[model samples]
Target chain A: MTAVRVIAALALFIPHAALAGEPIGQIKTQTGTVFVERAGASKPVAIGDRVFESDTIVTTSGTVGITFTDNSMMSLGPMSRLKLDQFKFDATTHNGVFNSSLQKGTLSVKSGNIVRQTPEAMHIRTPAALLGVRGTEFVVRADDAS
Target chain B: MTRLRLIAPLASALALSACCGPKDLIVVLPGADGHVGGVIVETGGSKLVLDKAYAGARPGSGASEPVDVSAYEVERVFAKALAARPIPPKTYTLYFVSGGDEIVPESRAELDAMLAEIGDRKAVEVVVTGHTDTMGSSSDNDRLSLERARSVEAQLKDTLAAKGVQSDSVTAVGRGERELLVKTADQTADPRNRRVEITVR
Candidate 1:
């Protein structure tokens, strides 16, 4: 943990911020922990952290809420599992694509214009079904088979 | 008369099954308790929901209020995804470095497994968010939170890409230290406050 912290701090010093178009500032959790990870690595998410596809973060308890770059909001409730598979946006074309899957637990989602523009571009999956959104907020939960 | 009696039972059974279709199932809501459970039944074009009111009462959080889960909440649980049957919600708590975006190394294996579970599903929407403890200035906290969220977002996109999942399906955001699990605002820095949250939609 300590080692990762050192690296994360170092990252802020580098000019990578220009490359990633990263958030305006430091990313944190409801618990007040700062965010850190290798530039191309996924950070593990905890309660209060907004989730994203590139990080591939997971939780062990409770729920987390997320607001995407396009202003879409999603919430994940306890024990639920999900992954941000892919997301790409072209501001000029107004084309933003996002996809993910929920393995277990529950999630509530509110889609925005980006998702509405490319309806097929938004996707969420559960243990028994796959959700394709056309701009709406929805929830899903699945039990752990194990 | 004999034919009607036999047909009546069959008709009723069919009707019941119809009401129990996959789209009609209701999900269990998170309770104050540690565990939460819910049930879903299909009714016409809508859904029938059954949930344990106080089933999620956590042991030490003061008194366990009667579980007041709303039918709408139950609906939200199932409404997040599209499926034919009830999908139970799973929970995970993440531990992060203080003032940083790194995850505990030991948690990787579990995280990897969960990632795979979601990655294999082509239609899922992944959400990643970051939060902060009450220890720092709100301005700094917000910056830290977003940085953390972006870091996770990068990681998820990279990992999934390696695993053959497309990278364009994920979304990431930062929420700063606005919400806390333990509620330790004015006094000290709570370790539990340092964390991030992930969800599926």
Candidate 2:
């Protein structure tokens, strides 16, 4: 397997861990393993990877994306500072809600069936705006011009 | 009391974050027959039609139960009689009042269902774009569309707050009648086409 796949593999079972000075967070991907480190940790995320929490930065080593158990997908752009502060999804009833904060950069989302099932459960935050999705696809950006 | 004390810090943190963004609840509605409930279009029957072959949901493993989709001519048909049967894919088109952007109480149930999905995520993007029917002047439609979008945005914020979904990651837009699902100028005043489109990202 490639290095990225190897990292993805190690990510899943490691549990939410914060290094000596890292922040708290988790990352999951499609067919890829899950990995997490606290904010400021030197860990890198690539395509098909995700990170959930505050104070983390996305470096160029890997492109990261997040897929909630309910099918909602968010792909973070390169060099972005995004955190998944909260997520609760119950597949039994098709109920999954999420809240995310974007301190900097861009992220694209293709929401899943949960929004159709429950619109109020989804929200996206940026410096200048707050976006509420009801099961449609869109992108949000925050940068110098934001 | 010790347990409560441990949880107090989390609760206080959540409360403090409430002002940074929106706090709303996202709810999911069950399906009746083949169709999931809460659709805006008036249906001939309460049962919804799901293209069984194409219907799919994620965190995908739970839907692997055995159900004969081809037993009948209809690819997929579930009955309201079996409340526990899995829900199928369906669509809903909400309508708004004339010259008003407020979503009626009746619509709250459906909105609640949508919010249930995204509110759980630590971070999500909800793109709520508003629309208006082609009955009024362009300016009026513009204002109406904005009002409608704002109304939905406010409702989402309030609902999320109640459900423990903090704000800070939500936005709303007013598209007016620029993008109508159905053109009313050529057809009747179809309430179905005049409303907002919420895309949870």
Candidate 3:
């Protein structure tokens, strides 16, 4: 009974650890300065930095572009704060979901196979409105200044 | 009330992000006053012109009440700022022979075209997916499809490395006969159904 319990515990723990280590995307380009906040720690964003779900990317005076696992690309302009809220893709079927929030500033996105497989799979949220990506490319800007 | 408003946006943001639909394009243009005057959002045969500041929108759903963007400013500065950003993603598809990982002879030219497209980019990431016809069992097709995808991925990595272009990541997946391009009955061998898709960014 004890051995079985330990085995079950290990089985549950292993997959969670693997999933947590899976990188959702990578920072392909960064000009000027960008930072990523993950798990409460903030670090400078550099070229080739892996981005994960729940990571918040803040760009102060430069632009940063990230290409996700599903081949979707997102470029953030200066003074932007974006978060990868959720991303799930089945590479084989090219079916997945992508959700992100743009707190402020400008963002341009080009949908990948996931969106081509199903249009509703991509969604971007701005401070004032929700932009459901139904097209191959679109630009969004969220301004909170009053 | 302030907190409630903030929470609502957050919750709705999550909700809105969960849905999927077909592709649509939206072009936002500002008025002479520097405020977002209207937007041209289109999908398929439908086109909508939204003149308000805020709007609840989705592709193919036509339009909803305008959302509040009173604080938003659509200026040339913002447009120019984004225009200077990085290159967009590029994708190419090449078909393969039935039940094999080999590319069809006719599609051999596409590999060069694909490589040429990524040759000039400073940064790159590649993803390859393989598919197969339904002639084989599911498990066998899965392995064959994966093998096809891996073959393309390996070639892409080798070519890029030989050129000294460092790819951030090269990932591949075999989807078996699940996502058929030509939707055929089981045991039917369709040439189009066997293919590999490569996406570079």
Instruction: Write the residue-wise lDDT of candidate 3 on B105-199 in tens digits.
Output: 87878877778877767656766878888997999999998888888777677786776656546778898998888889999988788888876
Better of 2 and 3 by lDDT: 3
True contacts kept of each: 0.04, 0.00, 0.21
Model 1, span B12-88: residue lDDT tens: 99997666434312233443343323333222233333345312211112322323446665654544333222122
Query: What's the true lDDT of residue A91 in model 2?
Result: 32
Per model, how many backbone clashes are there? 121, 84, 14
On TM-score, the leading prediction is 3
Q: Give candidate 2 regions above 4 Å deviation.
A: A1-63, A66-146, B1-93, B100-102, B137-140, B186-188
lDDT (C-alpha, whole model) for all candidates: 0.52, 0.49, 0.71
How would you encode candidate 3's per-residue C-alpha lDDT over A1-146 as one tens digit per residue?
99999999999999778656788888877888899998778989788788998899999988888878876778888988999999998876678899898888777666676877887678776555565665455467666541
Cα miss at A100, model 1 (Å)?
24
Better of 1 and 2 by TM-score: 1
How good is the docking of model 1, by CAPRI class? incorrect
| DockQ of each candidate relative to the true complex | 0.04, 0.03, 0.27
